[model samples]
Target: MAMSRNEILDQVKEVLVDALGLDEDEVTEGATLMGDLGAESIDFLDIVFRLEKTFGIKVPREELFPAESLMNNPDFVSGGKLTPKGLAEFKARMPHSDFSKFEANPDINKLTDLFTVAAVVNFVERKLNQAA
Candidate 1:
């Protein structure tokens, strides 16, 4: 049985609540895992693991959170912001994420802001749909 988007969001909220020790209220759809929920890099690994378990689906770390790879690569980032090519690549990689705000700044530091609860739901929704 395929889960609805709301169902996926609920489960994702649970996963984040447990993984980050956050209050359920803090896991709203627009909340960024890092900035809003105070999730560190290590928490992302646990969140991915929990999501995989909850959905019985694979959640590739790189696919969901590709910041590390882009950060270290000079070609992908320059001058503390994403290069034009990097921005394109980011948009491609995180299609589940909303880039309307980030596209304006393209600051590498704000990359984590893209990792919102809604983005996680979208990723899971895509994964489950793909499996179906």
Candidate 2:
């Protein structure tokens, strides 16, 4: 059974709230996991684990967030910054993310700024669809 967008959002919100110890109201669709909800890298792991259990779907860490690997790649990072190719690949991988602000001065450190609650929902939807 394919879950609707709203269903996905609700499950994501619950997962985030549980993982981050946040209130339900703070887990809106527009909320950024790190910025708005205060999610750290470790929190991301917890969220992924919860999501996998809740949805019964497996999620590869690299598939969901490739920042760490990308940063280590010489082609992706040169002069301590993401190359044009790197930015393009990031955008391609994270279509649900809003890169308008980050496009001008892309910083790998600010990668969390791109992760919104909607992005997680979209990711879950894609994975569920693939499983179906």
Candidate 3:
């Protein structure tokens, strides 16, 4: 048996609420982990650990958050914004994220927007399906 999307989202919310010290209502599908929920880099580790423990799935840090690598590459990033190549790589790497708004400005600071609660749910759902 597989968990439904809502179930996955509920678990993700729990993870975020505990890991980020957030109220349940703050962890909405559209909530950006960093921007909206105030999740620092360290919180991500706790979130991943909790998600893995809760779901019994391996959660790779880079697999879920590939921004660090992409941001450092000159070809991918220049002038504090993502180059076209960077955008392409981001799209490939962050398939779970919504790129519509980011594609417009492509500002490096906006990279945090890519890490939404829904994206976490999507990644967990994909990982669980793969395990199944």
Candidate 4:
């Protein structure tokens, strides 16, 4: 009884559209939640909550956004920018996110901006797989 990728994306779209007051068209897989979709930091919490409710899965905040963990790791950050190792780790952690722009500059403060609609789909899939 696992959900297909499209099913997950559709549910994710519903949550994002309702939570952020976004149009269905704007919540595409490549759409960055913060930069492209106008999602603020507070909206992140709402998104997570709605995803958990819709999917019946417990997604810890850190799992969706690991800024706190990254900041605390010296090897991951230095002088407010991501180290080479940090960039690799970030890519590994968030494979679903589009890192094209973020990789160019790698600003720690703007890390959340890397989150795309596809990332939510990946997260939900991982959580569901884990539960199974």
Instruction: Summing lDDT over every window of 10 consecutive residues in candidate 4, give the lowest-scoring window.
Output: 92-101
Which lDDT value does model 1 have at 47?
91
Model 2, span 60-94: residue lDDT tens: 88778767777788888777667999999898877
State the weakest 10-residue window (summed lDDT) of model 2: 62-71
**Per-residue accuracy of model 4 over 51-115 as CA lDDT, tens digit each:** 99999999898878876777889999999999999999988877667788888899897787778
Per-residue C-alpha lDDT of model 3 across residues 38-130, encoded as one tens digit per residue: 988899889889999999999999999999877889999999999999899999998889999989999999999999999999999999999
RMSD of each: 0.9, 1.7, 0.7, 2.1
Q: Which candidate is the best by lDDT?
A: 3
lDDT of 4 at 5: 94
Ranking of candidates on TM-score, top first: 3, 1, 2, 4
Query: Under the 3 Å rule for N, CA and C atoms, how many clashes does model 3 have?
Result: 0
Query: What are the per-model numbers of colliding residue pairs?
Result: 0, 0, 0, 0
- Model 2 quality (TM-score): 0.89
Model 1 Cα lDDT, one tens digit per residue, 1-132: 778888888899999999999889888999998999999888889999999899999988999998778788888899999999999989999999999999999988899899999999999999999999
Q: Cα miss at 45, model 1 (Å)?
A: 0.9
Q: List the candidate 4 regions with Cα displacement exceeding 4 Å.
A: 98-105
Score residue 102 of candidate 1 by CA lDDT.
95
